[model samples]
Target: MSNELYTVIPDGSVTTPRGFRAGGLHCGLKKTGRNDLGAVVSDVPAAAAGVYTTNVFQAAPLHVTRESIGKEGKLQVMIVNSGNANACTGEQGMEDARSMRDAAARAFGVAPHLVGVTSTGVIGELLPMDKVLSGIERLPAAVSGTREGSEEFCQAILTTDLVKKEACVSLTVDGIEVHIAGAAKGSGMIHPNMATMLGFITTDAAIDAEALQSLLREATEVSFNMITVDGDTSTNDMVVAMANGLAGNEPLHPGHADWPRFAQAFVYICRELAKSIARDGEGATKLIEVQVEGAVSDEAARVIAKTVIGSSLVKSAAFGADANWGRIIAAIGRAGQPVNPDTVDIRIGEIVTLQQSRPVPFDEEQATEYLKGDTVEIHIHLHQGDGRATAWGCDLTYEYVRINAAYRT
Candidate 1:
């Protein structure tokens, strides 16, 4: 929502003095000496809402934060670490995650429950607590409402990400200005039942817990839930939204007249952040948009869209810049949704690649050129009803395979 155009960078900063101070440090969790720990502390207790991976094998931080969110949609600080997922380490893993939250709460002088914790990296490994605690002790000094701090925070969130992801927008609602800024990190282990996504969104809007939760869920449904890179979800997937109420606007409620505008802003922020994740997907060279139209229902369309986007065959074709419509049709047939194959239509960009279960007469050169772009669109029409859905994905590349194969080594 800010007036600035989107820019690509390996490391960058974003600063919004709306009420939050953030810092990131190198706690030695990562072997590269890059910043791998981040802390976000609000000037005041903020309304918070979160959504975690549906995978039963959720990480300890997710389980603890889920309970905290249920108790109250509020938090004062968040601590995040990268390079070790801390998943499947049993009870000690949970304790270490709790200790991270507890240390942050103590450092910020807030209730332990008001501190949320998250980690990402290799699974089945214990977190390096000594380094994490040392980083926690330095959080206060690192905290700054400045561009340097923001850049550090963004850098601290990386794993296999080739570039840091950030989005921010400022909009005037009800005669008051509000700012929404967010940062996310994810490169591999991506799939829709939440993906490996880790997002932290900060807003200056005044909104209640219930409303914030509702908005975040709806926003994520259209954003994070509709993306896939590797079709593998992570145990540490989590997205959190925090509203510090720095904007003087009246508190937003579901029935309030300004609620729709506020919700739209939230959706925009989430969409931008989600798109950044896809663009920065592990070794991704292109961003793919899968658009499904005219399904039996919207839900069915979503299922089909995700299926097409997640198909390895389809993704591999995209990577090769091959305009293979058969893969798309094959994905649709096996999407587990009711579909009339005879009525399906598929297109790459504006070229109709398939029509009614057969290849349409179109120039392969044009389709290939479109596919070669940084952004690709795959459109499908079921011609059964007036329901539509769109999802985002990235092409599978050899670099992606290389990054993961050598990740643990």
Candidate 2:
């Protein structure tokens, strides 16, 4: 893609540049007549890195891509479809995912293993091969670097997303300019262990497969891994990245002098993408940042923070802006970690809700007023150790229930 932002541009065609071409087309898998199939093809071989769901009931695409990533870190194309998650379909499901890749490989004239596939939406049905294959056949013709094509690509991968999600960042490394652009789809089922959402990031920077994989994993840990929507991981979760070395910079290596600068940019892009997913969470009207400090360990802090964020009671309370400090304390107590309740403290925004083990006197009206904003912060101090961690989540609301209730219909 070009250094210019494409898909999300307000008044332009969704065209990308020469190094990348994307397309989204109607495949009939979705009843809404929205584009349900998309493809992203790199003009040349690119270093690829991916992280898949940790769920045991993995999707066919997850299994296939896992093997491919193990064998070769370079990829040329990705094929994705929405409205029919090829999961729990037995042996035939595996074939369907492979067929999707094989068809894309044929269209792009690349090896089947070099093509990555991802699917989302309704989990138990066989993929409609007629529609999927027909869509794959049209990929060559649909290939375009235009802004309109990029929008189509974003729309095709969406399932229940109310708004299309995208982020872009540019950086200069070694006097060379590089651009990173990404698109993601997630409104529900978004507790990512590896990557609970479907997101793709493309960059023209030159980096080897091994370095790309390392950088991607590091970035994902602090970005996608720290967010939750409903605490439910998906079977088809994936985050794929491609670096086509089109930026004309020197290959990046971990120990190299320029590695730090490149790594920073990589993490910045991943963080932006992760935040976009949280902001666009299904039926979410607010975003919450849960920050934990002074835990037994960084890992322990993360567990505690995620536990608090995942609590239905906590989420509902946050949605209601009830200033329920007891629920927050209760969540921390049940986090399965060694901690002294007497040493625990909690705060909302800048208002201390609980200090040490007792409630702190504060104006309920003031706290409620703070919660009315689109962004809220919850802080916890364990006073037990120096470790700290932060996680992102959204409040629970009736709209969330309504969206998922009729999702498949």
Question: Which numbered prediction scores highest in lDDT against the true structure?
Answer: 1
Cα deviation of 306, candidate 1, in Å: 0.5
Whole-model Cα lDDT of every candidate shown, in order: 0.85, 0.82
The weakest ten consecutive residues by lDDT in model 2 span 5-14
Candidate 1 ranges with C-alpha deviation above 4 Å: 1-17
- Each model's RMSD to truth, in Å? 2.6, 3.3
Clashing pairs for model 2 are 13-147, 13-148, 14-146, 14-147, 14-148, 15-145, 15-146, 15-147, 16-145
Clashes of each: 2, 9
Best by TM-score: 1
Q: For residues 232-271, could you state the per-residue lDDT of candidate 1 as single tens digits?
A: 9888999988888889788888887778766776787788
- Give the poorly placed runs of model 2, Cα more than 4 Å off: 1-18, 194-196
